[model samples]
Target: MRILLASPRGFCAGVNMAIDCLDECVKRFGPNIYVYHEIVHNRYVVDRFTRIGVKFVDHPDDVPVGSILLYSAHGVSPEIRKAARERKLQTIDATCPLVTKVHLEAIKYARDGYNIILIGHEGHDEVIGTMGEAPESITLVETPEDVDQLPFGPDAKLAYLTQTTLSVEEAATVIRRLEERYPGIEHPAKEDICYATTNRQDAIKALIGQVDLLLVLGSQNSSNSRRLQEIGVTTGKAAYLIDGKAELRPEWFEGVNSVLVTAGASAPEVVVEEVLEHLRQTYGATVEDAITREEHVTFPLPKELRVLQAAGA
Candidate 1:
């Protein structure tokens, strides 16, 4: 069997910065650090942190007053920050800068008196946080069909922002619908989907035709990972989203001679290696790298971590 591996598949720069911030916090503050949400969507990453005394909470009220709280990479709404402040929690923001950029765009568009249409899945932490930025002004749309359900009139002033992890093609379809409905709608200065997401999807597109099956290594809750799998399925190839090699079924290889392996931004490289090792041992697969685009983006550690490092130095 032949295995095609995608370059720039696993952890993005933003995920790296968020994970590093958590590691630094754990080292400096010791056990029992509080995180407002999953630092990233991967279950493996969260479980590792949990084993090391990190506490994940769904609500700010769950944390003790005067405790230290780290916001997740998904970014929090101003409302969440206010609640944390009310409890006297010392907060460290680990929000991905890309997500933060979307939030800022929402706030700006709302301030300028435009009705904001945010394209993302409902109830996702990132979407919730972004909508909270201007709840009264922002409407959430999951697909092109949702555009018709929007309450705004055709001439209503409007702007659109997107989740950082949406499928590029899906978002484009939604955007096209929005434009058809409201030709004068404004848009963010730049595309809101992050670079890592775009690169990973592009890589998968380059590999799909060459492979009989595709495996995406990511937790079920990971938006970008789900999008990758969707892309494979949309291309008429068999694809599965699995957390790791342990979830891989032997039956999946029955008629497949070539498989493409890729991972989400939040997934660890070690997990990807484990999957590759399984393929090697089971099918004696010959592996090759499919490069779509190279990524060199890096986000700095949060300011609080930087300050802590400077103080220790």
Candidate 2:
């Protein structure tokens, strides 16, 4: 069997900076440091941190006063930030800058008296954060059908933003619907979808024709990861999203002459290697790295983590 390994599969710059921020905190502050949520949506990454003494919490009040509390890469609402400040937790933000841009856009639009239409899956971590920015003004829509149900009048002041980690094609479909429905609606200065999300999906689209099966290395709850699998299935190819190498099944290789392997932004390269090793041992798969494109994005560590690093804390 041939294994077509994706080039730009795992750990985008935002994920890298978020993980690095937590790593610095762990090294400088020792164990029991609290994170507001899973630093990223990958189970393996979260489990690794949990084993090393990082405590994940759902609320700011759950963290002990004067202890370190880091926000997740999906970002958080101003309310959550206020709560942390009120609780006196030493807070460090690890929010992806792209996600932050969406939040800021929401704030700016709402402040300018525009009703915001946010394109994203309801209940997603990133969606929840961006919505919280302007809950009174923002409306969440997951599909073109949702757009049809919107109650906004044609004359209502309108603008649209989107979750950073969304399927690029799906988001475009919704955007097209919004454009048809409300031609005067304002758009963000740039697309709101994360670059990693777009690139990974584009890679899969570019390579799906050559492989019989596509294996996405990521957790079930990862939005971007699920989108990747959805793209494969929609393209009429066999696809599976798994958290780790152990989830791979022998039956999946049945009748599969070639496989395409890729990972989500939060997935670790080590997991990719483990999956490759398993395939080589079981199926004697020949691997080839398929370069889709080059990505040169980087984000700086949180100021709090940097200060700690400088202080030798």
Candidate 3:
């Protein structure tokens, strides 16, 4: 068997920044730092942090007063920030700047009296946070068909934004339906989808049909990872999203002569390497790294951390 490893598959800039922020926070503030949610969607990443004493809380009230709290990269509602402030918790926001841009768009559209329709999977952390920007003004749509049921006036000054980690083709299909239904409705001045998501999906599209099977290394709850699996199925190729090499079932390798491998932004490259190593051991497979696009993006750590580091220096 042969393996085609997708390039640019793991640890996108935003994920790196978020994880680094947590590490710096721990170093600066001690192991008692509380994160509002998983800093990133990967289980391995969260488990590693958990072992290091990072507490993941779903409710702000559960966090003690005076404790330092970090927001996840998925972002959070303004309400969450308000609650943290009310509780007098020292706060550090690690929301991906790309996700923050969508929140800003929602706020701007609401201020302009536009009814915002956010395209995203309902209940996703990023979707929930973006929707919370203007809950009264925003409606969530998951599919092209949902666009038909959108409740707003034809002249209601409508606008649409999207989740950063959505499938590029799926979001485009929904947008197309919206455009057809609401001819003059407004859209993001720039696409809200993140660069990493777009590039990863593009890489998958490039190798979909050529491979007998595809393995996406990502957490089950990861939106981008799920989209990668969907993209493979859409191209008529068998694909599975696994958290790590341990989840790799021998049955999946059956009849798969050419397997393509990739990872979501939140997934670690170490997991990919482990998977390949396992495949080599079990199936005696040869691997090749297929370079797709070059990504050089990097995000600076949160401002407070930077200040602390400078002060220490």
Winner of 2 and 3 under lDDT: 2
Which 10-residue window of candidate 3 scores lowest in summed lDDT? 148-157
| Number of the predicted model whose lDDT against the real structure is largest | 1
Each model's lDDT: 0.94, 0.93, 0.91
lDDT of 3 by residue, 67-182 (tens): 99999999999999999999999999999999999999999999999998899999899999998889999999999889988776566688999999998888999999988888
TM per candidate comes to: 0.98, 0.98, 0.98
Model 2 stretches with alpha carbons more than 4 Å out: 311-313
Separately for all candidates shown, the number of backbone clashes (residues 3 or more apart, or on different chains) is 0, 0, 0
What tens digits encode model 1's per-residue C-alpha lDDT throughout 90-179? 999999999999998998999999999999999999999999999999999999999999889989999999999999999999999999
> Residue 293 in model 2: shift from native, Å?
0.4
Give the Å error, residue 222, model 2: 0.5
Our model 3 lands, by Cα RMSD against the true structure, at 1.1
Ranking by lDDT, best first? Answer: 1, 2, 3
lDDT of 1 at 24: 86
